[model samples]
Target: MSWKPLRVLTPRSILPALAVLLVLLAGAAAHANKPVPFGDRVAEPGGADASPVTAQSLDTAGLELKVGPGLEAYDPATGEHAWSYRREGATALYLAMAGEDAVVLWDDGLVTSVRPSDHEVRWHRAVPGLAEWLRGEGETGAAQRSETQRKQLAVERAAIALYTVPEASPWVAVVTPGLTMGFRDADGDLRYNDRPAGNCAYDPVRTVRTNYAVLVPRTCTGSGSNNHQAFGGITGYRLDSTNWQLATGPAVAMRALDGQRVQIEDGPVLGSRVFDTKAAAPESACGSRTEVFAAVRPQGTCAEPVANPGP
Candidate 1:
């Protein structure tokens, strides 16, 4: 009976509690429906542009794409274009997501960093030797060059590719047939320029970014051997220290996997095994025996092959 004279809940006190509950419920629902980060989204194959070369998703913002003439960012939810950049004669050779920025490698050897949010060109840098190579090609008439010369030039051009290392501070690594260079993400300043060691010709096929390293899988052909007989292996570079080393496991071409792992064919009968890069050096028994014809990233784990193999 002494219990407070049947205390009634005051509207003021109850109102605040109700408001907080409603707010939390709204927040939880909003969070549940929130768009995932663009980088987390698996890029689709098409976009609004004709012959859309590539379409990359930006999660909540939209999808960025390399259309026929330029690069574009579109709102996937609304199917509305957000931003685009185009030039008279520019072709995007490669498009990669670098954190919040987009790193585009042009056919002319120009590398541009664009902020997808506002379509701002953060910085642009020209790859070494590309300008000179282009100029040389322009200077020579098709009739003046020998067939062998033309073929060689074509091979060299084909060897040029872009590799974005998100583990390396979102740096863009330009690997040419002759040399490799790394650039800073913030300013596009040169970070390191060095040719791969050894007399073997290194044709970089793909780059894999681990949690702490950047791995480049290259076909290495000895100086005198035909490039067709190249062997595949990866050169691992420590992102923090910038030190380069060869992977300790088998030379059989391996494909990068999520969670700092790689999948390589164990042997003809053994099928394949997935190796974690973060683990200690691979066992010596994992030595190279079978040739991995392709050094591309597998779609998933060892179960699937590369859906879109790199050049």
Candidate 2:
């Protein structure tokens, strides 16, 4: 696995996109603001409010995304409205490709899979919110306030990531403000509800998602009295902290590419390397990185394996 420079994902701010099917689970409160129909407020393509929509629109071919008060999808070739999905106050948090679809995660818990070509909604579903996840925490009002604070912190201090697992059919990791769960992207079926990594939280922030695994920027906070220490960056534990990397520096950038792989840019020295998380081989002999992901260039000569060509 000779580490080579390549690009697969987009910067987190833009939410990387691919020419495939898109399944997005964006959170929408039951009592959300009044609907803002598409075209009623088509953001001027490159306005401040349209930043989120711009990236998706440009990256995805044939799909025109107009996001302002609402999100609308149009057929660029025909200049026709294929479909329009809008909610008053929901933010487009994360986006990634999953096989023939793109999986998106929203601040609220609404998930919808839409084919960009024909703009057909294959499946859509909603998940629980932080307040609902912690239903047993405190009074309803207090719980809602607590969840709000966590969300604010997530925006200011941490990042939200959307990860897609193309294995066994596509499944999207729905990381809400409370828990991390997996849902089949093909349909809106719940695949697995994940446990909070030992002392760290996967919701709101503190957790990062890559195609192969979920990385937790582990901390004692959000563990709810766990009080135990945990790994810092790029956690290797299936659900618990078993192995790790980037113990000191700040969190790195990562994005999902097609073919069930992830490209991570650690720093200038490392440049960027696309890891074959699906590679069925012993880990790279040089970089003692996660055994499953085989990449990361070394300073010296080491045993390197053939990497599956990038798409």
Cα-based lDDT for every prediction: 0.57, 0.48
lDDT of 1 by residue, 106-146 (tens): 65667778777666777878777654453346554856888
True-structure lDDT of candidate 2: 0.48
Error of 2 at 231 (Å): 5.1
> For every model shown, what is its TM-score relative to the native structure?
0.55, 0.47
Q: Using lDDT, give the best candidate's number.
A: 1
Error of 1 at 289 (Å): 22
**Superposition error at 145 for model 2 (Å):** 13
